[model samples]
Target: MTMKIVKTLFLKAPPEHVWKFLTEADQLALWFHRGAADLKEGGDWTLVTNTYGKEGEKMCWGKVLEMKKPERLVHTFTHNHLKGVETTCTWTLEAVKGGTILTLVHDGWEKYEDDPFGMAANHDSGWDEHFGRLRRVAS
Candidate 1:
């Protein structure tokens, strides 16, 4: 058992609004963590989560591979604290009943298939917290 990209949805606002929150720098830091990105293809992103344990660490960094407006976004995810692993994270927005359904998926865990439990547990909780934060902010 290994990490299969976790996908979760949050329905609160329109796709355009949700897209703005995801792309904007200030809104992202408000709910998730303080970070910045050039936000273009092959551009870079930096996320510094001081609350992610230890004193202060600019832990996660990645490159933007694709950005398709309110429809989809694909990016590379890397944690400075975690070695030898990289994940491709994608965000897809779809129209739904009351509002937009935002789907966040992190693929590329199959490489660690032998350690399924740890991967599952790690991502399960992480997505819960992060998606919860996104819901609160998107609402």
Candidate 2:
């Protein structure tokens, strides 16, 4: 498996605005998923999907490792119900044309792969949907 996966998106807003929706848990719940998130170094972050189960039964639990606003965010991510695996997720923002170009790189997926590109393929599709959702939110 590759060590990293990159997903890029061209949003219709500036880095500052996009970063708000990306970093702030309230704004994030509007587009990404629902959960209470504390925006701080070493803060808690949990992502809940309504399609899955009750409020307390959702997945995507993690902690914020770095919280540099509007430019970079690094976090450790793991599914709430899944054990023995965790990944580092980083979001990088850059100024572009009339908006922001966001690149999300998720590294550390190599350990669970029994076949090459297995994790990459799974993440590729997931990111594609997520980027599309983010674009719609930005627009």
C-alpha RMSD for every candidate: 2.7, 2.2
lDDT of 2 by residue, 1-139 (tens): 3578888888879898998877776778777777666467788778777674476555787788997888999988777322546788899989888889888998777755454267657777887887777888875
Candidate 1 per-residue lDDT over residues 81-106, each given as its tens digit: 34656778899999787889777788
* Clashes per candidate (backbone, < 3 Å): 1, 0
Q: Pick the candidate with the highest TM-score.
A: 2
After superposition, the stretches of candidate 2 with alpha carbons farther than 4 Å from their true spots are: 80-82, 113-116
Cα-based RMSD of candidate 1: 2.7
Overall lDDT per candidate, in order of appearance: 0.74, 0.77
lDDT of 2 at 56: 52
lDDT for model 1 comes to 0.74
